[model samples]
Target: MRKTTFLLPIIVIVVAGLMSALFIVDEREKALVLQFGRVVAVKEDPGLAFKIPLIQEVVRYDDRILSRDVEPLEVTPLDDRRLVVDAFARFRIADVTQFRQAVGVGGVATAENRLDSILRAETREVLGSVTSKDILSSDRAALMLRIRNSAIFEARGLGLEIIDVRLKATDLPKQNLEATFERMRAEREREATDERARGHEAAQRVRALADRTVVELVSEAQREAEIIRGEADALRNNIFAEAFGKDPEFFEFYRSLTSYQRALKGSNSSMVMNPDSEFFNYLRSPSGGRAVTPPAPLPQAQVDAAEGAALEAAEADAAAGTAASEAQEEAETDVNNYEVDQVEDAEDGVQN
Candidate 1:
C-alpha cells in the first residue's frame, strides 16, 4: 500500500509535465512560441503544437481578415479647399514571426495603433494631391486604390497586408458648410433672374404683335364699310335722276309731299312762311303751272303785213258782223266747255 501511494504521486507529476509541453492551435488563429522574450518558433497550421516546459511560452494571433476605422482627418486639396474625410481599412497578419518581432509584447493593440498612423498619413498624402471635385466624383475607387497601395507598402515592415481602403464620407468642414450653401443659393438666384428677363422679353414681343394685328383688322373693316356706303349712295342718286327725267311735275309733287310728311310728322309741328310762297304751288293748283319759255315774237315787217290784212277783212265783213259775232261766240263757248270737262276728269283721276 505504501508503494502504491508513492507511484501515484510520480505518475501525477509526469502527467503535469507532459501537459505543460503541449498546446493546441485552432484553424482560425496562428501562434508563436517565445523563449525568454525571444521568438523561437511560429505555428502556422492547426491542431497540436509543442514547447519547452517552464522555459518557452505561446502567443496567439488571428489569421483572418481584420478591420480598423481611422479617425476623421482634414486634408487640403490641390484647389486649396479643405475637407473632412472619414475612412477605414481591411488587413490581415501576413507573417506572425515578423509581427511578434515588430510589436513585441504590445500585441494587437500596438499593431493597430501603428497601422492607424500609417493609414492617416497615406490618406492625407493621396487626398491632398487631387482637387475636391475629383475626390467627390464617381471615380473615387481609383483614389482609394492609391491610398491602399501606399498603406500596403508602408505596413510591410509591421507584418500587415493591407487589403483595401475605403472612404466613408467626404464633406466640408462645419465652419464652411453654411458659406457653401449661401454661395449656391446666390448662383441659383442669378440664374432665375436671367430666365425671368428672357420670359418678359418674349411676352412683350407677342403683345406688340397682337396689338398691331388688332389695329390692322379694325382699319380693314372700316374701309369695307365706307366702300359699301358709297355704292348705296350712288344707286339712290341714279333712281332720283330717272324719276325726275320721266315727269318733272309729278316728281316735284311727290317731293313736296315727302317734305310735308317729314316736316309735319308730329302734332306739334310748326312753320312760318308767306301764304302765296312757291312751296305751296302744288297744293293750290293740282295741274302743274310751272313757267315755260315763250315762242319768239313776229318780225317788224310781218307785224305791218298782218295789220293791213286784218283792216281789209274787217271792212268787207262789216255787213255780216252781227251774224259772225253770234256764230264765233257759240264756238268759243263749246271750246271752253270741252276744256272744263278735261280738267274735271284729270282731278277725278288724281283723287282715285
Candidate 2:
C-alpha cells in the first residue's frame, strides 16, 4: 500500500510536468521555443510541440493572414496638397524564429506594433513622392502596391511578410474642404472670363470685316449707277440731235403745234395780241405762212319746210311796185300844179 501510494504521486507529477512541457500548434499558427528569454527552435508545422520541462517556454503566433487597420495619417504630396489617408494591411509571420527573437516575449502583439510603424513609414515615403490626384485616382491600386512592396522589405527584418497594403479612403482635411472648393470655383471663373473675352474679340473682328465689305460693295454699286446714268444721258442727247438734223421744217412745224397746244390748253385761256401778229400765222392759213384771206360768213339757220325761193321773190317785187306807183302819182300832180302857177306868174309879170 505504501509503495503504490508513492508511485501514484510520482507518476502524477511526471504526467503533469510532461503536460506542462507540451503545447498544441494549430495549422493556423506557428510556435517558438524560448529558453532564458531567447529563441532556440521554431515549430512552423501544426502538431504537438515540446519544450524543456520547467526550464523552456513556447510562444505561439498566428501563421494565417492577419489584418490591421492603421490609424489615419496626414501626408503632404508633391503638389503641396495635404490629404488624410486611412490605410490597412494584411500580413503573416514568415519566420517564427526571427519573429520570436525580434519581439521576444511580447509575441504577436509586439510584432504587430513594430509592423505598423514600418507600414506607416513606407506609406509616408511612397505617397510623399506622388501628387494628391494620383493617391485619389483609379491608379491608386498601383500606388498601394508600391507601398506594400516597400513595407515588405522593411517588415522582413522583423520576420513579418506584408501580403498587401490598401488605402481605405483619401480626402482633404475637414478644415480645408471649403477653401479647396473656393479655389476651384475661382479657377473655373477665371477660365470662363478668358473664353468670353476671346469670343467677344473674335465677334468684333468679324463685325468690322463685314462693315468694311458692305461699305466697299455700296461704293462700287453707286459708281456703277453714276456711270450708267451718264451713258444714258449722252445717248438721249445724240438721238435728239439726229432727229433735228433729219428735217428742220417738220421739226419746226411740230414745235409750233406744241406751242399752240401749250398756249391754248383750256377754254379759259386768254391773250392780248395784234390781229396781224406772227403767232396767228397758222390761224391765217393751213400751210402756216404770212399769207392772209377773209373767210365768208356761214349761214347759221335753215327753214324746216315750205320755203319756195320763187314765191318769196314775187311777193317782195309786188310790194316794191305798189310803193313806187304811189310816189310817181304824187310827183305827176305836183309837176302839173307847178306849170299852172308858172303861167299865172308870166301874166302877172306882163301886167307889171
Candidate 3:
C-alpha cells in the first residue's frame, strides 16, 4: 500500500507538470516563447506546443489582416484651400520576428500610432502639391496610390505590410462651404437672367418678322382680288356687247321700255309736248312720222277707246325720253367727280 500511494502521487505530479509544459495554438495565431521575460522562440502553426513549465511562457499574436482608422487631419492644398481629411488603412504583420523585436508582441496600438504619424506626414506631402480642384476630383486616385506606395515603403522597416490606404472623406470647413455655395448661387442666377434676356430678344425678332409677313400677305391678297374683279367686269361687258350687237333695234326698244317702266310706274308727274314731238307723232300717225288720210267719223264709244290708247302710248314715250336724259346727266356727273378725286390724290402724292 505504501508503494502504491507513492506511485499515485508521482503520477498526479507528472500529469500536472505535463499540463503546465504543454500549450495550444489556434490556426489563426502565432505564439512566441519567452524565457525570463525575453523572447526565445516563435511557433507559427496550429496544434500542440511545448514549453518549460513555469519558467518559459507563450505570447500570442494575431496572424491575420488588421485595420486601423486614422483620426481626421487638416491639409492645405496648392490653391490655399484647407480641408479636413479622414482616412483609414489596412495592414498585416509581414515579418513576425521583426514585428516582435521592433514593436513587441501584442503591440498593435503602438504600430497603429506609428503608422498614423507616417500617414499624416505623407498625406501632407502629397496633398500640399495639389490644388483644391484636383484634390476634390481628378488627382484623388493618383494621390491615394502615391500615399499607399509611400506608406508601404515606410512600413517595411516596421515589419508591416500596408494592404491599402484610402481617404474616406474630404470636407471643407462649414463656414467656407457656406460662402462657396452663395457664390455659386449668384453665378447661376446671373446666367439665368442672361438667358431670359436672350429669349426676350429672340421673341421680339420673331414677332417683328411675323408682323411684316402678315402685312405683305394682306397686300398681295388685295392686289389679287382687284385683278380678279377687273377681269370679271371685262368678261361681263364683252358678253353684253355681243348680245346687244346681234339685235340693235330690239335692244334700243327694250331699253326704252325699261326706262319708261322705271320712270312712270311709281310717278305722278304732269307733261307738256309740242304737236310735232316724236312722242306725239307716234300716237297721231301710225306711218312712222308720215301723215295718214283722214277717215269718216267713228262711233263715239270706239273713238273714245282709240283716243285713250293713243294718250297712254304718248305718255309712256315721253316718260322714257326724260328718264334717258336723266340717266345720261348722272353718268356724266359721276365721271367728273371721279376725275377730280384722282387729280387731288395725285397732287397729294407728289407733295409728299
| Model number with the top TM-score | 1
Q: Each candidate's lDDT (Cα)?
A: 0.78, 0.74, 0.73
TM-scores, all models, native as reference: 0.70, 0.53, 0.60
Quick one: ranking by TM-score, best first? Answer: 1, 3, 2
Candidate 3 residue pairs that clash = none
lDDT of 2 by residue, 239-329 (tens): 5455555656555666777888989868848988998997776777886783323322222321211133334444545544554455455
For model 2, what is the error of residue 197's alpha carbon versus the real structure, in angstroms, after optimal superposition?
11
What are the clash counts of all predictions, listed in order? 0, 0, 0
Model 2: ten consecutive residues of lowest lDDT:
297-306
User: By TM-score, is 1 or 3 better?
Assistant: 1
What tens digits encode model 3's per-residue C-alpha lDDT throughout 1-352? Answer: 9999999999999999999999998889888889987888888889999999989998888889999888999899998999888999899888777777878754878888898999999988999998879888845788898889988888988889999888999999877999988888777666656655555565556555555555555555545555554555555555546556665644554465565566455464456658676554334645435533343343565455545555555555555555555555555555555545555554444344
List runs of model 2 lying over 4 Å from the truth: 185-352
lDDT (Cα) of model 3 = 0.73
* Candidate 1 collision pairs: none
State residue 210's C-alpha deviation in candidate 3, in Å.
1.4
The alpha-carbon deviation from the true structure for residue 196 of candidate 3, after best TM-score superposition, in angstroms, is: 1.6
RMSD of each: 30.6, 42.4, 19.0
